[model samples]
Target: MKRLIHFAACLACFTVFLLGPTIASAGVSKKAQSDFEKNLLGKDVKALLDMPAYKDGLDLYVDHKVDKRLDERGIDLKDLSKYLKDKGVGVERDEWVTITDAKIDSDRIEIHLGGGGEGHGASKNAAKKGAGYKRAGGSRINFRYGRDLTDADVQADTFLPLLGRVLDTSKIIGVVIPKDVAPQFQEAIRSRDVVVGMSYQMVLISFGEPDQKKVDDSTDDSLHETWYYLKDGHRWVVKFVNGKVGKVQVF
Candidate 1:
């Protein structure tokens, strides 16, 4: 009996030794975990990196009621609500957008206004409802990951965030910017200043994508590039070195 107990202890230690690095790598820093849980997971509709498994078939939770236009347009619910509210139209309370699949690949999250209803009676319902009610289209958002992202792809990503910001600005179901940080984003957008150390995500929130991207591969780093946004017949030039903002020029 004593020999068996000693062997069990040795096996446990061996298991720990073998799994130590994996355990460490799998473990998230407290701050990062908290950010994922609080800022993402439930708050935002998209994620850039691999987040915790959020239940692929689970419905997305919206803190507020959605409008009927969401069903037709397949856009963000909060935007629909704001437009109705501004128009003095009553907000509809019967609709919700389910997360068709929360587990996008490591680089992107695609969220449709309504789940595909794979296991549910969606197909049957669609047949019954006639051909007018089409399935909602999904929006795929990719993370920049500190690279010099192109204008087109970056602009595509800004759609959801822009809607989220609209909700945040109107104070109706704040999702993109946490209430505490909404002011900062609003201020950044107003000032038109891409701060010295802002990340690719921050730049998207601030000014969105430029109209064009000019690459400079003459240097060793092919990643070096400049992005240009046009305004008032002038160009706003943003230079990126190593994927972070290096210079800002308004010409």
Candidate 2:
């Protein structure tokens, strides 16, 4: 009986010794970490700042600490450390970032950030600084349409496909629009409209972000998601089934 007890005790200790590191590192799965890196490495910081998804809750980190110096820019130096500790959202201020490493705990993804030094946000050598994406000729484009132009004049087939080509070729993260239905997407954007088959991303680009959102799982069928937009004197409600716009209700 004494030998049996000693054997059991030794086996328990051996189990813990063998499984300790595996358990410690099992907080986040390997696929989750890889997905984070694949999507975020070497992306523009300003565009990320404007993203609704990232702004909602994604946490970011920086290797260099925030500067607290008071300069001619009239920046405040007080309570900066406390503020960063309380709110972990300031890494987007960098013009661009190259994700150095991504570590995920059970709750959040800790992105180890590296970027251009101070006053180097627009540095042409972004790739040399970190493992960033190859710089596209132009990342952002703004168009000013004349009042006389109408949907008929725009040539949806030609213009829409061209835009999709540009976005696909640039390989920008998160701006996915299918090339096959480029004409349909073009009409949606030009008219600021939504249809049954349009994607959530397409709706956002078409009419901008929604003013409010809600989720409903009351039915025994499936999850239903809705986004409400108030414009001029009208309210637009868009419903989604499995992440694609299923219907639109106007009030």
Candidate 3:
């Protein structure tokens, strides 16, 4: 009996050892991580930052951290306010860059840009001094979901809005839109307004899953959906006609 008990304890320890990492980041859905890797990895995207960025990552928390940092409101800013203030910007605003890597941790999704931060070799290769010196182009955007997450939380359509906080993936999956497309998308998310011509996916990203979803069957020909969302202490209604935003009614 003692031996059996000892083996059980050992098995418990072994189980913890094997499942530790998974348990640590269990809040992050594996599907969500996989989706990001499939979509963003090896993709060329435009930078959205208005200021200088660095090899060190810019941490973007989807939860209350934005409000805490007041980042969206900053007009005049220093280079790399979130990290590496002393170092020069590795990437500039609107610069086209590639996503070299992506990682989802227990608290954040770490997306690397321009080769996932500058390497020592790149920095040494271009040893020119002052602002004109060109270091390797690289930076990172760490998207933080502060609470327990689900696959729905980071699915491509909805996740893109949050991702717009750093990289403009307008050329997502090889579909290139205008330069202003991503910024407009980011604005839509901030305002939480469903605009006309927005597809069903865009609405999901900007407004999230509706509080209530119902199909309007009056016409009986084209597919129409009416979604209800509770935002800013009010219930708003959005009507989708033929899989596109048709009308947004506020109550």
What lDDT score belongs to each candidate, Candidate 1 first?
A: 0.41, 0.45, 0.66
Report the lDDT tens digits of candidate 2 across residue range 1-251: 99999999999999999998676545434554465456545643332221111112222221112333522222232433332233332243213434444343443333333421112233334323332223322222212221222222233343233223212212223344456657877656544567887887788877678999899775667768999997433588999987888999878
Candidate order by lDDT, decreasing, is 3, 2, 1
Candidate 1 local Cα displacement, residue 153, angstroms: 32
User: Model 1 lDDT vs. the true structure?
Assistant: 0.41
Query: What TM-score would candidate 3 get against the native?
Result: 0.50
Question: What ranges in model 3 sit over 4 Å off?
Answer: 1-25, 50-54, 64-67, 73-79, 82-85, 119-133, 173-251
Off by over 4 Å in 2: 1-182
Candidate scoring better on lDDT of 2 and 3: 3
Candidate 1 per-residue lDDT over residues 1-251, each given as its tens digit: 99999999999999999998666444334444343333233332322111111112212222223535432223344543332222221111122233333233222334322332232233344344443333433222222222222222223244334334212222213325334444655555434446555556666666677788888775574477788887433478887877777787877
Can you tell me which runs of candidate 1 are displaced by over 4 Å? 1-175, 178-187
Ordering by TM-score: 3, 2, 1
CA-RMSD of model 1: 16.4
